[model samples]
Target: MRNQVVSRDEWLKARVALLEEEKELTRRSDAVALRRQELPWVRIDKAYRFDTDEGAASLGDLFRGRSQLIVYHFMFGPDFTAGCPSCSAIADGFNGFAIHLAHHDVMLWAVSRAPLAKLEAYKRRMGWTFPWASSFGSDFNADFSASITEKQQREGGFEYNYRPAAPLTSRAAAGPVAEYAATTGADAATYMRERPGMSAFALEDGAVYHTYSSYSRGLDGLWGMYQWLDRAPKGRNEQGLWWRRHDEYERA
Candidate 1:
């Protein structure tokens, strides 16, 4: 749809009005960030392990001498032939900023349920340099609610994004879910067993503590592309699942 054409003066007046709302949003966001930082930390008692290119590593080892760690719970299941397209898009921006985060005493990593071999291959294909780890055969994904068991799926007893999700049924096998599943060479149920999220951890006094985690829509700010789209003329302007891995786009 087209916006109403207006003279420069009128457009400037409207823009100034909108600017006030934008400023208010910025102020509110700052307050929310402070509140988020004030959330209590939960000490991690379990010893979670992962397989990195460098070899087996514990949750604390992921910090790499840093006091803070951010892990992107990428949706790449054991049976998936490829990573989730949406996750791939989010990760596309990671490689560039990961080093900056590292130098700032924060290590960023992408952790997945897929085997290390598959992750390594896909990383090479995507030309990514960010650190990635495989949580296969580990309870990290399930413990963090990034993956669920078949029993949980069948019984509708799982929680994602801090809320219960509907059980997988034939109806759920259609639409964007099915489309994305097919692209990964799995059914909707198999594909959905793996979910996407981000978790933050803090290392203090020789103990690792989970500081924060966000899922579903909470991850919007982390997706760099969406940040840009929000500023575009048409806004998100999305229709269904229009995104693909960067390499999947056909050049004109």
Candidate 2:
């Protein structure tokens, strides 16, 4: 390889560019925080249900038997080949934050449209301790347009077939050529879009309120450093391994 090193001036320019970008990101985040406060929320009218280790639960029951609820709309759908690389990266940041968030009367959960069995199993594989639940049978995933819709699934769901026709595997789907296998580039990604992350209703004043949610691209800056690290010489462990065939693990 050639010694493609940057000169002092170029390095300074790069650093300056990064600082400018960081400032823009800060401005955008502050704007979004304001938007979160102004979010026009309506009462949760339907009886959305989810299955956890404890059993079935309503959307209101996600506070871990507490008053406030903070549900992260994790981006792993039942038909998805594997959890979103981006969401998994975000989730990697969740458990640590969860323990701390609990000190402030908030409980965090990683909820997905994947089946309880699949979601719980992956949770174990990732060695995550944070609470995770499944919204497989409910429209909770759809009403929010998290992942693919029933209609989109009707179009044969997104996959990474080894061949164009063969079912796509995690490795094949998320390879660099596939650009992380996430086309949204994290922009306003839905649960329907992989790596999308967001919280559900908040309970305040005996009412539920909308807070914040993000698509694959929307989380561009917060953990944005990780994606940069992905391109580093060390490479990112962003693809699935043991649980890649999660659906097949228990079948036989």
Among all candidates shown, the one with the greatest lDDT? 1
Kindly list the per-residue Cα lDDT of model 2 for residues 164-243, writing each as its tens digit. Answer: 12333444444452543433233222323432556546776555555555544555544544667765866554554322
Q: Could you tell me the lDDT of residue 15 within candidate 1?
A: 99
In the predicted model 1, the residue pairs found to clash are none
Q: Which digits, one per residue and each the tens of the lDDT, describe model 1 over residues 1-252?
A: 699999999999999999999999999999999998999999999989899999999999999999999999999999999999999999999999999999999999999999999999999999999999999999999999899998888788889999988788888778999999988878899998998999999999899999999999999999999999999999999999999989988851
Clashes of each: 0, 14
Candidate 2: stretches off by over 4 Å: 1-28, 65-68, 79-82, 153-195, 221-252
Worst window of 10 by summed lDDT in candidate 1: 243-252
Q: What C-alpha lDDT do the candidate models reach, one value each? A: 0.95, 0.63
